[model samples]
Target: MILYTPLANTDIFPADNAVFTKRHCVSYQNKQFFVEETDKGDFQVLQLLSTDPQDFLRQEFNPGTIIKEH
Candidate 1:
């Protein structure tokens, strides 16, 4: 099949279910984020799902940033 898009391959064809267990889609400050669970029981920002370009400029949503769940 031919897929024409800018998304990464992994985003199109996902891997095993086990790989998704560590990841989660969370909503914070009215923004959606894909985060991964860290060993310290914190959520590490993986990707920001937003249409606003300004959201990307925010430091908090940057990948690799860690967040603690309340």
Candidate 2:
């Protein structure tokens, strides 16, 4: 089944302990994910995926196959 997630241009969590950003995103089975927003929110939202200190970030490898990271 295909699922769609709604996103916003606002921060869902508070920033602390270091530089923080609010990303409007949705995950596909916690594997492949994507963040959506207007032009203004693109940098802050999409950039979070490939930002520095990449420990807390993830990637969506494909659009099929039991939702596993390639």
Candidate 3:
């Protein structure tokens, strides 16, 4: 499984350094990804937890779950 965080903007802002307090879990083709909206109201991928399709089918995989990098 590959984890990826998509960049919303190339230009860095001071606020970008701030931790994301609110985030949403999204699934595409059974892959789960974490996304949060920036101050600019643009959606950005905070983290990508799993790329495995079967992982998304698990009961533990739900929305509003906090994902962190190890």
- Candidate topping TM-score: 1
Error of 1 at 37 (Å): 0.8
* Candidate 1 clashes between residue pairs 3 or more apart in a chain or in different chains: none
TM-score of model number 2: 0.17
Residue 28 displacement in candidate 1 (angstroms):
1.2
Task: State residue 4's C-alpha deviation in candidate 1, in Å.
Answer: 8.2
**In angstroms, how far off is 19's CA in candidate 3?**
7.7
Q: After superposition, how far is residue 55 of candidate 3 from its true place, in Å?
A: 13
Clashing pairs in 2: 32-60
Error of 1 at 55 (Å): 0.5
Tens-place lDDT digits, model 1, residues 1-70: 7989999998878886777799999988888999999878899999999999999999988999998885
lDDT of 2 by residue, 1-70 (tens): 5445474324444346233333334554432234443334332223233234443433433222122223
TM-score computed on alpha carbons, candidate 1: 0.72
Error of 3 at 1 (Å): 36
Q: List where candidate 2 sits over 4 angstroms from the true fold.
A: 1-22, 32-34, 39-70
Please give the distance, in angstroms, between residue 56's alpha carbon in candidate 2 and its true position after superposition: 14
lDDT of 1: 0.90
Candidate 2 lDDT trough over 10 residues, lowest sum: 60-69
TM-score, per-candidate, Cα-based: 0.72, 0.17, 0.32
